[model samples]
Target: MTDVRVLIVGGGLAGCTVAKMLEDEGRGGDVLIVDRDPQAPYDRPPLTKAFLGPKDRMVQSPPWAPADVPWLADCAVAVDLLARAVQLASGRVLRAQTLVLAAGSLARDLPGRDNRVLTLRTVSDALRVREIRSGGAGCFLVEGAGPLGMELASTLADDGASVTVVDPASAPMERLLGGALATEVASWAAEAGVRLRLDTKVVHAVPVGDRHAVEAVFSDGEAEAFDCMITAVGSVPAPMMLHGSRGAVGAAVVDDMRRLVDVDGSHFEGVFAVGDLAFHRDADRSLVRSESWTAAKNDGEAVGRQILGLPAAAEAVPYFWTRQFGRMVQVLGAIPLGAEVVPIAVVPKTGGMLYQASIDGSTVGFVGVNAQRLVAMLQMQGGAVAEWVAPEV
Candidate 1:
């Protein structure tokens, strides 16, 4: 059995970031990274954006070299907390002084069996979708109007394919952007030549013929046939591997410190969870999980620092960004459902717009379209919208 001071599961952004930070702090020699994927860690956001383009190529991060951190390309099947060891599919057992779970999440698959339908989550999944799209102009139906779905639809439309986006939400990203921005995005989709089927749900997707096509059945008893179908319904946490004497096989519970909590509400010592699998407890004792890339990176860095007995990193404000319909949308902080939105600036020449969302006269969030500098300045200043001079008409 191989023994290590720290064993990190999952090779995605969170795991890699932690390993890199530890190495930079002169603690790399005692770390081991185990990942199921054979390929080196790569940027994942592009799988639904730039990677869909015909001329784009897969981008991978450089492997660990200076510290030469040990990497085990194997799947961890079971975790024996009592023995402080993990069993891998290859019949290898690894004992660790500390275990970090960054297993991430898996893409939710569409209901029913239809080999023609695809879902994008991994590099291999992106390659397969790109290959199918390169076959020529054909009808593509994308389920879910969230960021991934919309981005994929935009890319497919730009590639000369007929794209249709179906979602149960009133508008694209309604929950995140609220009504005003969602409506604007819907218009953007229309202008980009992508069809929007809002307030609609796809019941199932079944093979329609022998020509690699799928017929998607809707909640309204309407069926639509398309050359290809992709589901971006969302993702769920990956299967948890830990097992304890108290029968806590997959503890989704986590304390504010990001430590896995047992069924009895006690945190396990020497164990930590990060990324999508972590259920972080807020100051109010409410558990919330952040699936954003930035959140995962912050979680890793904070956890690494804590393990090294160093000062905790400053908490990062929630931030997210995406590109669709040739427009870059950036958001910071939470904008409540009924928040008052005030337009701060509009630059027609640059096609930029900025808005500040406030509740009870205190700014809570900022949304910008192609106005990155203004958004960054507001974010740094921290509270209430700053007065700005409007550009001369």
Candidate 2:
């Protein structure tokens, strides 16, 4: 094996997995992971659930193991890609043969949303949300109807707080889960005393005394208020540091087929990127977007294998899961919004629905709750979301 000294930027799931894979492959000397956060890499998904809940469900892991390997626990200010040197905030420059850009993405905030609006991206942010939530019964306004918003609403609802999830879609998770599962999720929320307002848009957020309220001057001039607010709308690539990198956007740009940076594929020899920061393209050069932990793990491992001169693994499946109101929601594939959706299954009285997406007779993605095993089985059977199967209730 070539003595390839690897400098990994970003300390989240992507960086951690890459470092672990390298060590597991007995290539410790070829790896060094750097992260801006002082604390070790921790899971971010649970922040909206167990960590923010009353019980103890926090899971922790060191960014990198073994005292011999170095983990630069600080922000990387810049990267001298040509010279293969990474400049840290502490004025330290580290050299490496190859660099993996996995800085990940940031919480996409709503327009006019203030910093007072809670976001659950990092541990610190999660702690703040938990503190505010545990203080007392308060109203929360979640700006998006995505998985994070639903999970946060459920956690807050469990804590005896009213959560109002706002989204542009006509129904909660309508775009991804389709009408059947979205209705099931909405029913679950209603049973839990959580309010779901579809087709609503927020005009702006204003402070009322010590409390903050959002003015939802919708298309019809309607308004609403809440004591606290949290934005789980979405996430965008956090590639602000790669401004100087050639053709690099807010995230590092990479060609999926070539597995190299967008710098002509010849500028930085042997350098590759994975995870959220890596702007990747598929066979048609169509951007493949994913920011889940599983995607990061798969991407990191693929890059590692490629570095080891192994055949590239199959295109990584983008798998992710969410928990809301004690229900386990897992998605294995990407359900293209506006695509044809069909319901697959619905349990007896639980109102759980399984929906799949199909594009030109090819199953692409699926979304379901309490049916992880079923979904796994379907995927194993070469199922691509061909159609949405209604609940056979």
Candidate 3:
């Protein structure tokens, strides 16, 4: 058994952010980050974009976090919440005063299984995908129309490779942009020669005979065989070391402060959860689970502040973005379907527009298509973006 001041389980953006915060405050020696993944904490956004394109670079750690920040390459097998103790795979028990569960999530697979089938979630996955692309795997089957799938498809298409994206959603990111706007975005992607098969799911996937190719059959009874197949179906919370202790769900349920809260509404004093694994409770009493990169970093900031008793930063609006074909779509806050949209800017030539969306007469979200300047103004305003972009007449 060993004693630690702070034990951060996971080395993704959220965990690394907290580690960086501590190191900035001269507490680096007291923090121990346990992660199974070999790569150091890195910015994940570029993995699907530039990393897969030309640079092939991994944004490992924030600039402020020096090379010496301690990280233990191990797996946490179990957790004892009351004792604040975690049992590692090597039979070592680490007891800490503060526990931060930033264990992120892993990609969910399709119906059938084959190790050859690819899914990009880690540095290794990206490298493997890159290697294959470099080897001339031109025809690609991208399963799932989520941001990840779309980003990968775009990257390949830009390289003059054939990309076919299949997903169960009615449109690309239909849940985020609504059918109307999502369809419009898909149209732009079409211009780049990216084939989209929406409202479809892969019922089966199998590697074609000795050849380095895979054939996937969609629910629509259509089958396509490609040189390579990748699935970005979505992600499930990584297996953390919690077992519903104290009436807690088998999830990292946390409140607005990112503090772990029991299902019965009780808080665990020095314990918190951040990143994709956290099921966060908002002011509206809604349990929102966001997989946005911005949200993960923001959660880490909030947790780091709380851990050091520092004053909280301004409340950050939830954000998400995707650069598919000829468009860069940005979403700030929550924009539900049927929300009132007030267009602020529009580029008639490219069909790019920036708009503010609201529900019940109160601004709640902003959507921008190829409007970076307008989007920045709204993002910088955070909750007050509504005022910055006054309602159109």
Tell me, by lDDT, which candidate is best.
3
Tell me the spans in candidate 1 whose CA falls farther than 4 Å from its real position.
Answer: 53-56, 62-67, 282-286, 382-393
For residues 171-223, what per-residue lDDT tens digits would candidate 2 score against the true structure?
A: 77664454436667788899988888778767767665564444445544777
Task: Quote each prediction's TM-score.
Answer: 0.91, 0.85, 0.91
Cα lDDT for residue 328, model 1? 88
Q: Give the 10-residue window scoring lowest on summed lDDT in candidate 2.
A: 383-392
Once model 3 is optimally superposed onto the true structure by TM-score, how far is the C-alpha of residue 260 displaced, in angstroms? 1.0
Query: Model 3 Cα displacement at 267 (Å)?
Result: 1.5
Model 1 RMSD in Å is 3.0
**CA deviation > 4 Å runs, candidate 3:** 53-56, 59-61, 64-67, 244-249, 282-286, 340-342, 347-352, 382-393
The C-alpha local distance difference test score for the whole of candidate 1 amounts to 0.78
lDDT of each: 0.78, 0.69, 0.80
Ranking by lDDT: 3, 1, 2
* Shift of residue 282 alpha carbon in model 3, Å: 4.8
